[model samples]
Target: MSGQNAVREFTAQMSVREGRWRLYVALLNTTEQWPEHRFGHSVPTFMDRTDALSVLGFAPVPGAEWEWTEDSETPDDPASPVVLIAAIRVCSWSGVSV
Candidate 1:
């Protein structure tokens, strides 16, 4: 197995605390070998797409190469089981294609 992966579909929520914005990573897609994995991380909001990659164990990919296919304000946090978000697309750190 190699030291990289990809996320075919990525979904995340937004959060704010102490006057700072952050990404509240919630859901993640997984490869055929595994089920979709849920994640939680309070990462500072970054205009760079690849910022959350390494933190999730991904090797490396250009942050700019990633294009946001979906993004919308989410209010389900306080109402449901949600928290900070930091997600990746097309891959998982376990060498699985998401």
Candidate 2:
């Protein structure tokens, strides 16, 4: 695929806000593929990151994880660790076989 038909790149990130973990996804370069979602608008937030990933049709690769030190609100607090998935794959449209 090339140009308009090409699959765009997307990056996912997670951060803690108000004691709750939130998942964020970079907007797709082309909205033509996902007309249901609007451009330059706020996306909805899900309490569970797994749920958000499901709705977005993405899954993390097995054994790929990393610590997000930038999101550590209290670096001095050893009790709180910011571990996040480092790699992910776009699942099939049917939401099966990642």
Best by lDDT: 2
Q: Pull out the clashing pairs in model 2.
A: none
Tell me how far the alpha carbon of residue 36 in candidate 1 is from the true structure, in angstroms, after superposition: 16
Give residue 64's lDDT in candidate 2 (0 to 100).
Answer: 40
Models 1 onward score TM values of 0.30, 0.41
Q: What is the lDDT of residue 51 in candidate 1?
A: 53
lDDT of 2 by residue, 67-91 (tens): 3444344567877765433323333
Model 1 Cα lDDT, one tens digit per residue, 1-98: 34244343343333444444443333435333323222244434343334544454443333524233332345544544333433444334544443
Among all windows of 10 consecutive residues in model 1, the one with the lowest summed lDDT is 30-39
Following a full C-alpha superposition, what root-mean-square deviation does model 2 have from the true structure?
Answer: 8.8
Clashes of each: 14, 0
